[model samples]
Target: MREKLLGLVALDRLPHACVLESGTAEERMALAKDLAKALVCKSGVDRPCNTCDACRKADSGNHPDILYVGPENGRKTISVETVRNMRDNAYVLPNEADRKVYIIDPADTMQDYAQNALLKILEEPPTYATFLLLCTTKASLLPTVLSRTAVYSLSPVVGADQSDGQLEEAKGLAAELAKALASGSETSLLAATSAFEKKYELLPLVLEQLGLILRDALVAGSGGEQMISGAGKSAGSLSARYSNAQLLTMVEAVEDITTALALHANKNLTLSRLVSRLAAGM
Candidate 1:
């Protein structure tokens, strides 16, 4: 992830909008700030040069052109009115930097109306504007919003506040399953899926772990293995066994299964179909 971001900074090919999928709020915010700072940096050679004034301002969270929008007043969701204001403000000229960057923390917190309202600006954002949508659950977001943005999923940052212990455990099991699926270990795959019977609720976490594992494998196949963490063995093995296209298919399959589970799809059937697809792909 750092390598990809650094390459973007080097090539000045950063997307107009991006989705950072991360469970840890602290990691999300830190990445957002780093990306924002890099976008507005004067030197522009290496991202977020700590010595730069723009980087300093971003570190202080007071950059006039670097704005943050989120749910307010203990509200559970972001209001449409706030999105409306953001749409209006997006057209405004940057105060100091060459670009205006807006970071929306937990963008999945936006209600349907708010998400719809924000979609307009995302589609035809101002030339000098950029948007960063931080989210834990991509399933809650509109496909339109997702299609118009670059999506990057990250694992929980080490030592950060990790309250979801079950999810972590699920990921461990999922990692083993992913390796088994890639290696065509039918017995292991069946056994792993059987574990889901005792805790079907962790299906989402399992699917997410599989997606991340496949993503890393594809990256490794494409020469970015250094970007992967926690799933390096599975990624390395999968990359050697599958082509990039095949890895991508598995990633999409995992994401689809995850979204289906999130929407209350049949667990047994989904698990069966998922394993079938994984097996067939290999």
Candidate 2:
């Protein structure tokens, strides 16, 4: 993902709008800053040359051309007025760099109206401006908002212990689930998910791994590199078999089930709902 972003920077092919999805808020913000720095870096081609003035300012979090937008004054949600203000400022020229970059952290917190306001600028962004929307999951953002931006999913770092026997079992189950999903067979899907009915403790890990597979599928479908080594074949088949919307729906389903499990919801019911959702979507 770093290489892909850098290549885009070197080629001056950064998208006007982008969505950075990750499970960790810090990871999303970190990458957003790196991309912003690369975009505003003074060195042409060899961007984010840490020695450049832009890179230095970005490192210090004082770059004028790079702006961070979010809920203001302890507010939980970003308001339409705030987004409108951002739109107004987006028209202004950059303070220093050749391009102006706006980083909207926790973009998923925006309400529908606020997102609509953001959509206006996304639809007709300034040629010299770039927008980076950071969120924990793409499902939080509206489909219309997602359609206008290039989406990048970042993998979270797993502990060494997670790479043990349990992880392997989770990966196997996740692969089966992915292939079953792509096969469009309800019985296959149920049989695949049945493994989770008894092993509730492993369901989270299985769902997490499944999310990665779907993420890889989305990336592969968009012509980016796949992240999961063991799931590459499954990801490739999923990419070829499902539309982006379908894959995204499955991703959202995984997220939903994960959240439900985290809340101590009924395990069997949650797993059943997931299967039903996937089957209905298909």
Candidate 3:
């Protein structure tokens, strides 16, 4: 994936602006920093060689040519004043590198006025200047801003779930969830309970895989099955207790918690509450 993105930001091309989205803000920031290093590397290699002086400065956030625009005072949103400052810096010649790189983090958190303020610079960006916007809220961005920049979405890592030769069993679980969702029959509910017991007997350390399965179920419209996305055998055994709608609501609630966790919310309590909610909803 890094190689693919490096190709997109081709050094041969001199300069360009882009927006890269990732599953987590941390991952997005890491990618942006690496790209900044690559842009200013004196060696002009595909990636920055950390041994080089330019690379070291960039790694330390001391690179004169790389500017960052983010919330001041750890605020949640970037202000229009910050955007104005970024625009002023955009016109200046590179201090120590061939190109100037601007990275905007949590671009989605920028207020409407701030985004509009950024539009003028994006429309007629300085020569050899590059802008990269890292955001998770693609829908919230101004359409004009999106139109000027190349956009890329980083998908949630697949197979991040822990299942030991359980793909077949998972498929079976999918079918069961699908059936339960289709019919409000008592047998369907009982089957869901049984599936929870058989498939997720021991929960995986990483819940992402299970979460993905639940998301897939939602996409497939199998609401009944989605409720059991995080359930272990202990919980699955009583799946019959939940209605299809109730299970779906539980899944949605969990997804909301997942979003909160990604934003650096209290993970332990949030997860425990999500689990408890799922159990209760069922």
Q: Which candidate number has the best lDDT?
A: 2
User: Which stretches of candidate 2 lie above 4 Å from their native place?
Assistant: 156-282
Estimate the TM-score for candidate 3. 0.54
TM-score of each: 0.57, 0.57, 0.54
Best-to-worst order by lDDT is 2, 1, 3
- Residue 86, candidate 1: Cα error in Å is 6.7
Model 2 residue 162 CA deviation in Å: 12
Q: CA RMSD for every model?
A: 7.8, 9.6, 15.7
lDDT score for residue 134 of model 3: 91
lDDT of 3 at 187: 53
Cand. 3 Cα-lDDT: 0.63
lDDT of 2 by residue, 197-269 (tens): 6777888878878877776777687776625436888989988988878887786687678778878998768
Error of 3 at 90 (Å): 0.4
Q: What clash count does candidate 1 reach?
A: 0
Quote the positional error of residue 263 for candidate 3 in Å. 32
Candidate 3 segments whose C-alpha is farther than 4 A from its true place: 156-282
